[model samples]
Target chain A: MTLSADGSRAGRSPRRGLSMRAGRRLWLAIFLAPAVVLFAAFVTYPILSALAYSLYSWEGIGRSGFAGVGNFIRLFTTFPYPRLLANAFGNNVIVFVLTMLVQNLTGLGLALLLARNPWGARAYRAIFFLPVTLSLVIVGFLWALFLNPVFGVVNKTLGIVGLGALARPWLGEPGIALVTLTLINAWRWLGFPTIVFLAGINAVPEDYLEAARLDGASEWDVTRRIIFPLLAPAVTIIVILTFIGSFNWFELPYVVQGVSGAPNRATDVLGLLFYRTAFGEVDTGLQDIGVGSAIAVLMFIMLVTVSTVGAVFLRRREVEMG
Target chain B: MRRLCTAMIAVALLATFFPASVLGQEPAKLSFWSWRTEDKWVYDRMIRLFQQRNPGIKIEFIPFRAPEYATILSTGLTAGRGPDIIHLRAYGGLETFAAPGFIAPLDFEQVPELKRFPLQTIAGARSRKDGRIYGVPFATQTLVIFYNKKIFAQHNLTVPKTWEQFITVMRTLKDKGVVPLANGGKEGWTLEVLSGVIAPNFYGGTTFFEAVTRGQTTFRESAYTGALAKMLELRPYMPTGFMGVDYATMQQMFINEQAAMFIGGSWEIGFFKAQNKNLDFGVFPGPTERADQIPWVSSYADGNYGINAKTANMEAALKFIRFTATLEFGQMFTDLLAQMSAVPGVVVKNPQLQQVQAMNRKATPYIMLVGFRWQAPTGSTLLQSALQGMMAGTLTPAQVGEEVTRGLSSWVDAFRGR
Candidate 1:
């Protein structure tokens, strides 16, 4: 029973089936060597040590010499580092276009009002996913003490409902501090795009929404012409995770604006200028680490070339709207 | 009993992995560290009174998190591992660990009370590229103002020495409704400590900090843009959206009296008498444009006590950093941290720390943390983001003195090629 005499002499000699296809290619390189050595020790060794510490000139942690690209030509010709890198890349493109228009129109109007399962729809989907389970340092320290422009309870409930001339200083206005931190990061990621658009509206095909509601259609034309074009793979997984969480925003504007993104820096971003240039912040006095490894290698080549060209142009609009 | 519970779990894993070689000759412990996480219960009661005056030593302490304690103490002393007494910071945060040797210089024979401090508070722990003295100088602070005194004795008011009687006593305590500047601007270093308490009486203090650290005259001079236009003329006596008032809501609007004055820093007098034990308050120092000028204040040197040059208990961390420069640990660190103790004679016994040690004898150098915080665009981070863009009007006290002489001419050889 030697494996049926070596599987009938390895199907009549193809050099004994090339040693059984080199013993199944050495068990597929020993089952892909520990996820390719843990993705090259935690993602290609910290992006090639932040591209070799963005060409030298360190200081605190010492490296001192080489400065070839000279900290990316002083982070784009210095003077407040090119106006704080174009005001932190224009506040990360206004926190990714106002957190993608306030989290896709309030996450597709709360997934079309919680896909009709009215009253306690699983306790209103765990109370709209309870601020994505709290801790962004307790939602930026309870929204910087409930937007404290004087003992805050939101300007004393807009001065007890009279609206007190629209209580302003909501984050000390520098043209409304990055739209009040993109509406508090779309109120803490609008329940992750309302549970991915209520599982893309309960997987849409109820006989193609009852043949477009027996052809009478209009529930806003079966929600804007067929469940918003079949919720194109949950809007391309929330537009490539809101373009990599709006350029990795950094701990709720560093726990409600402190790393110098205050009133003037108007909610600065490139993750609080790469954590005040690689962690120096006693109100940004020292740490350079060669311009924080050239702002972490220009934010990893702008979030991998705009989220891989917006995830291949939104996966070709989810295969031409599936 | 199951072989005596496996021989007492191998002598409790050999005393939890050789805690100093399982006590054969224990006591050299050391460690320390600090950032003051609220002075760890007065440094664990001053390390148990320096471990009962050094009975074969044993310290420990630790602390941290004061804004991630200078990047976790320079990444734990650049990974050579840390603590054997450290707590540094004064002057360019102690020349970022005494110009990289990671501290350990001191002299007068291993810190003989760094010869009783004051050479400008031991030049804030020295080391400007090896001038030496690594660390010891501990508390100084100053700044000034404070006020309240039961809202200036129920608004009868007085102290205003000059700046037009301090803008008519903050316009009669802002027409009596009060909040006469509990200072704010959502903490860009408390608007650089309110431009070091109103820019050293319109930037002429110590003759503009020795002509702006000898590059002859810089912060775009008109006496430092008339002290950033007297901090935008104390922006309508402060509080109302004082740029979204922060430093813990400007110390909870001056310990809840709803703000009568504040300015800040004599380490907020033991956190306003431990947050209001009948909060009266007093202090002063800022107003001078004329009542015979000598006002000044703006002090500095608020840190030190170093050692760790990879300290394997260097003689119990130099006898616990020379018992933190003596005078009985500077009168128990100015009677438990009300502060001022850069240790000279140390006999304040707190009458408001003896008027902050007599207005720190007309002090001066808080100018961007003493001579432009050493390097890379610092001058206290370009005057705390140009005084938070001149208190958010989006800048102009001559553009916060031309944005702090163009970020200290990118590295101050007296504002280089300005």
Candidate 2:
């Protein structure tokens, strides 16, 4: 009787334990179900479908014939393919560098200046951030109009200032077009970063600044060592966001230059090229869908890779101030 | 889990219920998509008239802007939710849509007035390989030289009939501190007309269109090279910051009397007139050196309406198209929009259009260069880019030609591979 009782106790304990575990798992699954399903439907399915599409000669309509790696092969050899890729990558890198250097530097400087509670600081913030809130399309069109050589305010003002020689076509010359576009891009985005950096600057305890000032530290030194270090998180966020935005850039160039990326194809970016390849233009017939898909896949891979690298490297520099 | 289940049930129920009556309907509502917002008044009137004429048929008008139209159309077709009829601008990529069976072939016998339209217009609408009519003939437009009469009178110059005279007149205007040509090299189409059409037609005589269409002659050997050379020669006479100006800005220069002459299509007449009704302007054929060869005129159907393959109301869609083709609708629509009709009996009263009509009539023997008439997709961009490059000084005339050849050949190979 004692042996049977022991055996029954052991069996009941394990069985009860198993049932409890099962119940816990069910609860966990129930909690996670919505997110998993949403992610699967939105992200995973589209990516897998894109991958499948990358192997076929589909025109985004009707029966898509299978073409395997032929599309990828054609992308390298086709008309201006190599040049197009180079132009896109080079332009993107240049824009990214320029934005990081100019936009961030200018933004940080502005934040520092504004942190001093300069006159009309509130009005200044509103004016500076206004462009950021406007649509990129509207900004592009507005800039295109403003930069018009004949009647544009820029050239007209330059002429009025007796600097007519310096007022050349901003968006037309190949050497200057990308630089001009980058500057415009920086101008548009600077406000967002400036606001964030200003918030970061404000968050720095006033006592620390006062202590540094009392310790005979110059304003530059305080900014460089204390405030700047603390503002690293905002800087990192801005950099990552900027990197992704630059890599995925399309609308501005598209609206400004149209489909040909004209003025000698100076403004052709990867997004525009991908679209042209996929949709075909007046001159080029429809590009092989497989090849276009491959280009898209490459673009996706590039954006993901760059973003990941940027996030990891920049996040490491983010100082968690105790 | 419960939320997900509820959402799924809702989606399933909606999907099932929405499509049931749609599937059961006969003479279903046919949706016609167009990128003609500027002419919405005329289109709406026509649609109403069509509906009044055919009470059994229901038509839905889906209008989008030009840029968004292509994306929307492609998306809708791919998703199996495409409209019954679609308006397609004449461009090179039509074959891609036709090849995939996303476009349906039109039976011309149903609308026999197809014979009255220009053969080139019909040719552009037909699939090159299968010879199937996929689009209804609509309106035709051509590039014409638009010169400001006030500027011309100021410079004491008349509309030049010869290429040499045109250059001479332009030089004279330039000497007077007036910009000769209102051109935006930033917009590649202006560059295309300057290099691809004007240059080649004048220098190569009748062989320009032949060489391009046949794909045997390189752009280098054609008069197109001469055109580029001429453009280079005339570059000094153009307005400062010519490269920076866009189509609208350039047109505004001409309209505002900042520039003397503007080369553009007939489509701009209405816009220009609307902007400045009193601006004295005259239209003339693009100048040519060889008067005997007949001034080669370029004209093509601007846009055509086609029935979607997935249309639920094919008969109703055809009825709408037939109604749209009638003389009453065609004339009224074309007149209000200031466009030359594809329908034979529709008369356009605008003097500029009358000049274009006369030119089209006179140049009937000369081959009309329909830039849209290409079976391959890459030819248009190739032409545009090559011309643009030449105009921008990045590419020489010979190099531009080579690029066109290379682009076309590569496109051919790509299409064949597909």
Each model's TM-score, in the order given? 0.36, 0.87
Q: Listing candidates in order, what is each one's chain A TM-score?
A: 0.39, 0.84
lDDT of 2 by residue, A111-177 (tens): 8899999999999989889999999989888888888888889999999999999997798876688
Could you give the interface RMSD of candidate 1 in angstroms? 8.6
Q: Ten-residue segment with the worst summed lDDT in candidate 1 chain A?
A: A1-10
How many clashes in each structure?
A: 0, 10
Where is model 2 more than 4 Å wrong at Cα?
A1-42, A59-63, A119-123, A205-217, A281-288, B1-28, B116-118, B203-206, B290-293, B361-377, B413-418
Q: Model 2 scores what on Cα lDDT?
A: 0.74
User: Judged by lDDT against the true structure, how good is candidate 1?
Assistant: 0.82
lDDT of 1 by residue, B289-389 (tens): 88876788889788788888878778888888888788888888889887878888888877887987888788888887778877666877767776777
lDDT of 2 by residue, B222-334 (tens): 46565557667767767788788788888888888888888777888888898898898888887777556456666666667888877867777877777766788779866
Chain A (candidate 2) TM-score to true chain A: 0.84
Question: For all the candidates, what are their Cα RMSDs to the real structure?
Answer: 23.4, 6.1
